[model samples]
Target: AVESEAEKRDRATREIGKRVMEGWRILDKKCDDCEVPMLTQGKDDDKGECVLCGKGQKKVLTEEERDRAVSEIGRRMLDGWKLEDEDCCEVCDLRMCSKGDKKECVACGPVLPPVNVNLELPPNFDFSDPKALEALLLQVQKKTSTANQVPPTPALSEQKEVDKVNISAPNTPNRYGSNSNNYPNTPSSMQMQYPNTPSAVPVTNEEMSMIGAEQKIREGWTMMSRAYCDCGGPMMRAPNSREAMCVNVHCVNSCY
Candidate 1:
């Protein structure tokens, strides 16, 4: 299909493939003077010398190599280096000189003279002022005193009272108890006692009730047995209970 003039112009301006362009290029010929490959003007102009540097054929870099070279050059430029041109010695191709300064080349003059030096001094620190030294010592002594001084201990109670806790049952398993022999009983004036031992301290009614409750719990009570419903209704035993559930009718089979 024939493209329109504008489309044709756009397509013509677009980049051509390297392979196609290379294939279209006429083969280059080696220049006789430089021995470098020179682009042939035509098939008839195959044998010739280089146009620019007539000594030898210059090797043309591939695209990838050229890109790498450009990247390296850019990296060097970023790191404060650049390619610069300078005039070299036309005769020897290198510029160098000797003696004290730049005038004749190294071939004509003696080298620079040797150089050296020597000196010595004693090292010492000053702290001889009695007033200043005394002040510094006083400051250090004050800091040491402040650090070493112990704070006064605070009183824990107005007066010490012996702990009145009394345990009578040697057979009773309590996690808090640590006795290996028959229990000791100290008759305290404040404690109320049971008739079993007049020598033992008395247990009040509240203590007796607490001990009884603890015993009851140790015998059989469990968290599931104490289950309460979301509505706060007390739990009742379910037959064949696979999981703990509430007793409320409103919460059928719901977990407590």
Candidate 2:
């Protein structure tokens, strides 16, 4: 097939870009707007350019631009940490500097801690879906309602009545007879006697936590049963958020 004018022009442009960036180092980073591969030049890789788009960076970025770039980089990184580029070493052109009175790059001086980024929703989050939005809102409302709720304490008379019932329940006569000793005073026996009534078992702190986690799992808020975190730990979905976190206490990123 004969090459169209537009195709020929695009091919020519790519060829020209290749020649122009022949000696430059190709970076793994891509242009945000063009989605084209970027290349860098100079002794410290300070200069950057897109092969196809001609978008180049020669001068230092402004404070706002630097901050925005750091956020963008953090979002792209799997480590979930943002970098400070305010005083990056000119020698390495990298932001591996210690955040002190005087920032120094580790490659040339000292190590710096990366700032942790906020937990973001999963990549598959869809804001346009009405059902998903409704579910999220409902979860938020449920949590709010639970937090604001205060259990009403029993009055002294009510407590006395409850105590009386508890003391008399065991002595109450049954078809088997009061002194028959046919049943023990165990929970099982009580359950047998009052089969239609619900048991009021006192839940421990640990058991309560487990029950809450199980409830979330039942509501399809967690994927722990089907999927594992990167650290080989069970993953639970964060409340009111699409983010999933490792449930293993020993895992370094468990809190995340």
Cα-based lDDT at residue 65, candidate 2: 42
lDDT value for candidate 2? 0.39
Residue-level lDDT tens digits of model 2 in 1-256: 9787577556634443333323344455666665655665332344467655577654455554443333322222212232353656444454542323434332333322322222223567454455754454454434434443444333221222221111112433232234334224222332112222222432222222222233333344544344444544445676578777754333446532
> Model 2 compared with the native: what TM-score?
0.19
Our tally of clashes for model 2 stands at 0
Clashes of each: 8, 0
Q: What is the C-alpha RMSD of each candidate to the true structure, in Å?
A: 43.2, 26.3
| Candidate 1 lDDT over residue span 1-256, tens digit each | 8676566333322211111122211124554653334432111132233433433333344554433333332222233333222522222222222223422211111112211111121233123344543454354434433443444222111113323323234454232333322222211321222224333334332233223322322334222333444444333333454554442222324221
Q: Candidate 2, residue 156: CA error in Å? A: 75
Q: Output the worst ten-in-a-row residue range by lDDT, candidate 1.
A: 15-24
Among these predictions, the greatest lDDT belongs to 2
Clashing pairs in 2: none
Candidate 1 lDDT for residue 220: 40
